[model samples]
Target: MTTMTPCQSLTIRVYYEDTDFSGLVYHASYLRFMERARTEMLRSLGLDQRALLEGAAGAPIFFVVRAMDVDFRRPATMDDLLTVETEVLAVGGASLSLEQRVSREAEPLVSAKVRIVCVEAGRARRFPPEVRAKFERLLPDQA
Candidate 1:
């Protein structure tokens, strides 16, 4: 059976602050949207970044972006409602890869492949079982 991976979507409205003088969203704005979507995805799985990093009764764990490959296919203007879709592409002992896309009414505007690494005390660390389980549940089926 082919399992459907968990995907999360967040809607963001383009504001003047997110755009350039031309009223088009700056390229960096898409990156911010994608980052928010990823954070929300983790929250949906019961992970709180602030608490995790603050060591609130648990070992301090931090998620850091290791690499990003982004493509800007189109520009969004102020007031445009953009949807950021995030999906888990892969998970490793100490890293996770995600695919995120920004779309406007079903039309893709930007796409990115992001790699994140798990760190504790400035060193890479394997994901704890609880955290790994959450990600595993969202793992895409291998073709």
Candidate 2:
């Protein structure tokens, strides 16, 4: 297995709109947060989801989540600066394992592991050679 530092990361503030009736971020909100981070991470690798989906960059490609296990350890209140961290934990022929966490002051509020399959036309397919090569280049050096 290999780990890839998010090619990019976008930090965001927890706003009132992100919370529920109790002012605590709703359970499903974390999924949106992770999605944003993951999208940006792919953008950093030069894969623009919008362009791809619009056919400007080619056939629409997506990494559909095949499975995910998330743990909600704590609640994040409004006005908090939450950092969403994403890392590529493993790369496979047609799928990758990603690890993500939402943190405040180095404390984990949530952590999740997601398995995503690379797809085109709704069928799982291997990533392009160039994309896989680029992803390898994003990995930290071996020990």
Q: Please, what is the whole-model Cα lDDT of each candidate in the order they appear?
A: 0.88, 0.79
lDDT of 1 by residue, 1-143 (tens): 22334777899999999999888999988988998998888888788889889874268999999999999999999999999988898999999999999999999999999999999999999988888888888876632
lDDT of 2 by residue, 28-50 (tens): 98899999988877877777666
Note the residue pairs that clash in candidate 1. none
- Cα lDDT over the full model 2: 0.79
Candidate 2 backbone overlaps, count: 0
Candidate 1: residue 132 lDDT (0-100): 84
CA lDDT, candidate 1, residue 80 = 97
In model 2, which range of ten residues has the least summed lDDT? 1-10
